[model samples]
Target: MSESIGPVLRVIGCAEADLPAGPARQVAELEAAVWPGSSPGHDPALTPRTMLLVDGAGTVAAALSLLYKPVPLAGRTYRAAGLSSVVARPELRGRGLGGRLVAAARAELAADPAVDLALFSCDRPLAAFYEAAGFEVLPGTVLVGGTPEEPLATDHPGFDKVVLAAFFTDGPGRDRAAFTGVRVPLHPGDTDRLW
Candidate 1:
């Protein structure tokens, strides 16, 4: 665990069975704070192959989940990593905890030979933050389940409504090939609705 200004960010590779209930609850709380209306299910724990936890003065500040999955993009087979459930405590925002957690996850993902690409979905406001972290924006529709929808928005049509936007990622150059101006596939979980 590495201590930051107020919290200690620890990257843990623990199975679902190993994480205690207290930490799990904290993770859920942070998730809810970040994404309203999203259910933080209790039964199936979020035990990503790689997880990062940020604790501020003994309290959970931020966390991220990473999973290695096969992603088919542009008719090519890519062993990519899915980054999900990224959240930071309301009081901890702008402290760089989110960026730190993401950087840690990226490093870990890059270490795995099978993980050639990393993917995640973020609202428009945070797009700049991700770009600063090395992710480049792509112009395309994100197919969620059976429907292809628009990019994430807060109001109007709401998150369920599709919008014209694209995915972004840190260009693959440091170790993996850079993905510039590439149309990659993004699976937003729901399978019945086509975006």
Candidate 2:
């Protein structure tokens, strides 16, 4: 790994209301590129709140939107954090920018009093990438999202997602067994196709 770049990590905004007009366009552009065939302002889970990793020259090296929803499972609800549109400038892929951004997001989750855990889905080939970035792949585990009337699973055909997760709010999360070998109900809603 190159000497970890001392990029500036800042909270750009959390909701549409939080985004300053100046950076919102850049965020949306990055989102469209990272998550193709999707438009901005579609999912309620993807509140406009975003985080940025600015390189030393002040360019938006990487960006991602934060998603939050109360994940209910096994008679309990955990405040969960989800990540979307995580991307680094195409020219800057192997320099550790993406990993740095993810690490920072994890720190944000851990520091929040309400966020009990963080989870996201990635393609099978990207599982090792996330693992290198500190996310653990939950084998045989599935995240049930979408509407309660028509739930969607990460394992659904055509998606073949691998669930990556980390826990923070202590208590039950301290026990890995609680999350292993089970299907977790995430229910992020229909608009959040990647959740």
Candidate 3:
């Protein structure tokens, strides 16, 4: 459960496994509509959680996934969480529901003592949306996903992506600058190729 963010909209969350049947189905349908055959949004190995934004009628308005895992950046490993698979119902796209969900998730991560930072990548065009939700674009930083053996990077040809992040705690040796302009070896593995 979450505090009401609007008169008619509230944010609720659960571990991916704990999501109730109704919202689960809505989330599945929404994912299929947006990403025809993409992998599941929550990677169990990453301790994933799902956040749903719902109207007062108890209908899903928007949804997103959060994955917590150790992320390596600039030679140090930090506890991190990444936002993934964000989608607002087609009819509700222009009303800022997705932005609300993302901001709520950012707040949740910031409040967690275990999370050192939040990191994720979005298409170049959507960078501003994520920025409006309180994430700072890390210019020229590449997020490398997949395993080191078969990595995928934001900087790869034909992929216009930008890394966005919010540091909740000081990183190794209390150095935040270590993350700037460097490649983050996120490597959430094959299932989430670029989470």
Task: Please give each candidate's TM-score.
Answer: 0.67, 0.84, 0.94
lDDT of 3 by residue, 87-128 (tens): 999988999899999999999999899999999998999999
| Candidate 1 vs. true structure, TM-score | 0.67
Error of 1 at 16 (Å): 4.3
Superior by TM-score: candidate 1 or candidate 2: 2
Candidate 1 per-residue C-alpha lDDT over 21-94 given as tens digits, one digit per residue, 9 for 90 to 100:
77777877777777777665322222254254545434666776664445566556666555566778888688
Q: What is the C-alpha RMSD of each candidate to the true structure, in Å?
A: 5.9, 3.7, 1.7
- lDDT per residue as tens, model 2, 1-195: 112346444333356556555566766777777768767654654443477776444467777777887777666777788887787878778988788777777777777897888888888988887787677887788878787788988878888688888788667455345667688877777777555
**Candidate number with greatest lDDT:** 3
Off by over 4 Å in 1: 1-9, 41-47, 56-58, 141-185, 191-195
List the global CA lDDT of all models: 0.52, 0.71, 0.88
Candidate 2 lDDT (Cα, 0 to 1): 0.71
